[model samples]
Target: MSDPKSLGLLAQFETPADIMHAAMAVRDAGFSKWDVFTPFPIHGMDDAMALPSSKVGFFTFVGGVTGFFSGMGMIWFMNKFDYPLVVGGKPLFTPLFAFPVSYELTILLSAFGTLFGLALLNRLPKLNNPLFSSERFKRATNDKFFVYVETADPKFSAVETRALLATLGASAVEEIHDTEA
Candidate 1:
């Protein structure tokens, strides 16, 4: 078997601008497995990273449509076939009467879709990450910015990646290894 492989190399930056520039360079260098961490959301980072648009809206739309149709079907089955009811000679299945319940189900299922879609898409509930092992990385949530390029990338080379990060003005560069590896 081969030796354990590295997870990636992490470079710390003093400011958002520094991290942003590093991300662009990494992207342009044809590195697909890289990420940037910031204390808070940074505007234009999406464009710099070349990330794709989220598909959560598609999930919500599907959920809403399913809810509306199911609501209509349920009302029709109950009133028209299961047990026909005549109150003051009203129609068995009236769209006017069904509107309220249909609207409610549409909102409810759409919400469920949005919640579950986000969780699944983001791979949520991840209790741990290797990056958390670094004491310096803890500052990422407070004030520091970071850019990391994984060794799994096609263009990754430990020495060359470190050199590139240094050239981009990284304050500190550190290699991260996978504990399980």
Candidate 2:
């Protein structure tokens, strides 16, 4: 009977400069529940938005742990478990041989962990979102940036939000809806 709750507003910008200004304006206005989308990352934008760096280091740590164990296991399997070999009179627990593959696996696993972890943490792979409905939002993949504030935020109100965006010099602002949430 009533328009579904709004996801937020989508303000599209034609250039990084406009987006940069928008970010600063949003930050200065003290709006924490917002994000910027750009064709490519722009330097200083993160600082402008005051976004903290992600805790991907924790993911890397998990990956490194996996890699270390896997590497050690492979060596143990080949040297001790399955095939015991005496090469050049070297001991079976030779760290030298294991180091290369082990190191490689460490880097590999850490990288995979970072990728998977980020995706999981961000809840990505979101192929469709209400932002897709805004005609101007298509430029995000080419040369546009956007900032959205969810209605769930305490500061959100159609009239007040529009007023804030206008004060922030948002080029164009339009409401976006996400019925399914």
lDDT of each: 0.89, 0.83
TM agreement with the true structure for every prediction:
0.89, 0.88
Model 2 lDDT tens row, 104-160:
999999999999889988889998887887788888888767888777777777788
C-alpha lDDT of candidate 1 relative to the true structure: 0.89
lDDT, model 2: 0.83
Regions more than 4 Å wrong, model 2: 179-181
How many pairs collide in each candidate, listed in order?
0, 0
Worst 10 residues of 1 by lDDT: 1-10
Please provide, for model 1 over 32-118, each residue's C-alpha lDDT reduced to its tens digit, 9 standing for 90 to 100.
Answer: 989999999999998899999889998899889988888989999999889998878989997888989999999999999998889
Q: Residue 118 of candidate 1: its Cα lDDT?
A: 94
